[model samples]
Target: MNRERLFSQLVSHSGPFDIAIIGGGATGLGAAVDAASRGHSVVLIEQSDFAKGTSSRSTKLVHGGVRYLKQGNISLVLEALRERGLLCKNAPHLVHSLPFVIPSYHWWEGPFYGIGLKVYDTLAGQLGLEPSRYLSREEMMELLPTLETEGLDGGVVYHDGQFDDARLAIHLARTAVNNGAITLNHTRCTGLMKEKGHVIGVKAECVETGRQHEIRARCVINATGVFVDDVRRMDDAKTENIVAPSQGVHLVLPREFLPGESAIMIPKTDDGRVLFAVPWHGRVIIGTTDTPVEHASIEPRALPDEIEFLMTHAARYLTRDPRPCDVLSVFAGLRPLVAAKNAESTAALSRDHTILVSDSGLITITGGKWTTYRRMAEDVIDHAEMIGGIGVKHCVTHDLKIHGSATVLPKDDPLAVYGSDATEIRELTAKEPEWARKVHPKLDLTCAEVVFHTRHEMARTVGDVLARRSRSLLFDAQASMNAAPRVAAIMARELNWDAETIDHQVNRFQKLASGYILEG
Candidate 1:
């Protein structure tokens, strides 16, 4: 489908849409796709760029939570495993199986973990992904030579899926658009439009032009993740604080630091959290320290204590000590967990999502992981349809094909399609060689991708392109800073932005990126 034409159609057309979804993260985007594919007129609005929140800041793993199995949450694990397999099948290019090694120090450790993993595989059954296998010390060392071999008896190797979380969200958005959903990024929902006592639509501001628009829909879905309570407050003052925002931080180290093909899954850390050293986009991503967070923000900054915690835990199994100096980048994300009445810690909070329709009639869906977004969307739509009295057909997103997703790889792969750009990039290497190296070595990211982001993917600024569309900023901040001028120049030419506008874009990007650094 022509996205530009569809967007134009949405802007010109005015009526009560079947569904209007808030937030552009995985849940909202997935809901949009499901609703649109079912023949419902849908509009999705986000305050920031899509996946700019917790959705993008994931561990990038699409696996059954192994730790969940240890906690006897077998149902959650099985469901996640099924979804992981489905995602891998649906988006082969974006999602691929990643083998992980769980190193065991004691002789019994291997068998014990192996048995658990075997149970994990058994739970998945045919739906289960590739089974886990026991690997000897020699085999483990072969897979990951940098692993600390001292007292290492053996290891368990298992396969789990990995994906570009932002890319997947983008694909979901595109799919929704393809199925005729109006998705507006940089659109902020300021208030809920109430009729008598029922929520009928939303009052939103376009972040770009600061223009206000009233979107009328039969049902307004507040799938704003952690901000669910804030949205709910518009209708009822006594809306329970459903979400307990928990902070999870990750540290990015150079690939040379790990030097391995497979990731290492630390089941339990000393601090009562699971740790993972996953290979992601050419960098070693060691993370995730879960702590309580009171305030919720778009950009969640990682604390120094969190970084030190990760380094200390990772050091236990690694050959070399990973210090703060070795850290390339650090990021933090807030998980919108449902607050349990008797829960002691955030780790014990339920990952399962909850959907609530308030007395004033605002449908809110929150507290779920990236892996179950589709299912969450389905549930949200089902709830919205019932509340709105809209008789929508069954969901078709289960078998829907997302935009830019192909069941088969093209004959001209990444190298072939990007080779010429690689050469041109090499010719201009001195000016900005990393740009060329990333795409083709001879060519920087081809003009096509940039155009695609703006024209189709709803990228409004240079930061959107670098940070989300291409991910140049996350990998190499300095290089992204250096390449900003060139990218802005390209954007200015296409978007017809004046010099002042280009400068504003560049400055905004710099200021936003500055937050990633550890301040004294």
Candidate 2:
């Protein structure tokens, strides 16, 4: 999926493709893999870098919706649970099982949640990761040493799954490429190409070069997450908006806040939502306020009140109060909640996915969470094949391993983002010792990672390297800012950029990094 290969494929392909997919987030990339693996000719376009929006900003859990179970949404819970296990088996490098505990404040809380979680495990059937158990106060304290002890009772412990969302998206894109899917980033779909009021193809333009092309296809599928309505309107100007965006925010704190491997799940927050303090990338990720948003933006910022809400909630559960100064980075993402009439609030909206087929043959999929992206993709392809009159085949992605997921070998570097590909990266570092050096003094992100992702992972900007590829920006924005100059220099060398372009990259990265800083 190098720049040259992607560009060459885009220019050389001269056929009526079986399917054309818009958006390069989780669902779009997954559908590309699904269709291509099933022996269909497929092409996908992304306006910006892949996963630059909602897909990358997830809570990073691949769990069966335990909260959904509480609301008696058994079907959604069961489906998510099944996908959770499947993802763990398919992408063992990225998806791993995690133990979660619901700390209790009342005596009856233990039995109540413990029974509920047991039923959750039962729903998973053969796909269950682990069984649920009850943890005593002493045991809970041992796992969550920083938790507030005065009002604490025992806790209910259960198991779920977790992963790196952006990394998974990157791997999906690579997997799609391996399966013969034509994928291009920085390419925007301007409008739907129609013939006799049927969607025949798409009119796309490269955002970087302003070059436009008409990619004719037998069918067009829109998987644009929060922006599905925009594409739907292109197919039919009278299309009704189906997406109701809801904002969720997360804050990264020092790992000491959640020192153990087990994650703490607060089943009920003051705002009637759930809170989780999970350990990820050597840091603790802890708010997810469900505020209704009228619009969706790529780089959404956390509000001052949202930051205060998270801090106040943390103070209630933890012995140590993490001030705004303690926040390493804060980010916000919008969930594309499918609009339901009489749904009082966005929180009341279902997490289940919605797929709609317009009269003009546009298949748009939206409203699913990250845990169920694979199934959503499979469904999209199935619908597309039906509408386009292609010979549909069974999906192979349920068992297919993503790119660089084969090897189980371990690595010395903690920041080694690629699991099985660690050896290849290490070999590169041996040839160029400077590549092994950390870009910033305090960060373990090495120079080799910057070079590896730029040359292979379709990394075109400093933001892609530090933010998504290396995850430095998510951990510490100030440190990421410090590392930007070095990252930009290496990218300049790899992409053959001039001094002005390098400066521009650094400037843009710095602006993005600034948004992650929480107010003190």
Each candidate: what lDDT?
Answer: 0.80, 0.89
Cα RMSD (Å) per model?
3.9, 1.2
lDDT score, candidate 1: 0.80
Note the residue pairs that clash in candidate 1: 421-443, 422-442, 422-443, 423-442, 423-443, 425-442, 426-442
lDDT tens digits, residue span 1-520, model 1: 2334655776687788889999999999999999989999899999998898999889989988899999999889888888877777677667777898999998888989999999888877776667899998899999988889999988999888887888788878878887878888888999999899888999988887888888899999998998889988877877779899999998877788677669999887888888999987767989899989888988888877887799888787888988766776677899999999888889889899999888878899999899888788888998988898889689776776665555434323542222223233334444544433343232235455665567656788887787777766666565667677777877787778999999999898878776665443
Clashing pairs in 2: none
Tens-digit lDDT track for model 2 on 40-95? 99999998888989998888999888889889898899889889989988888888
Model 2 clash count equals 0
User: Could you tally the backbone clashes for each prediction?
Assistant: 7, 0
- What's the lDDT for residue 323 in model 1? 74
Minimum summed lDDT over a 10-residue window in model 1 is located at 415-424
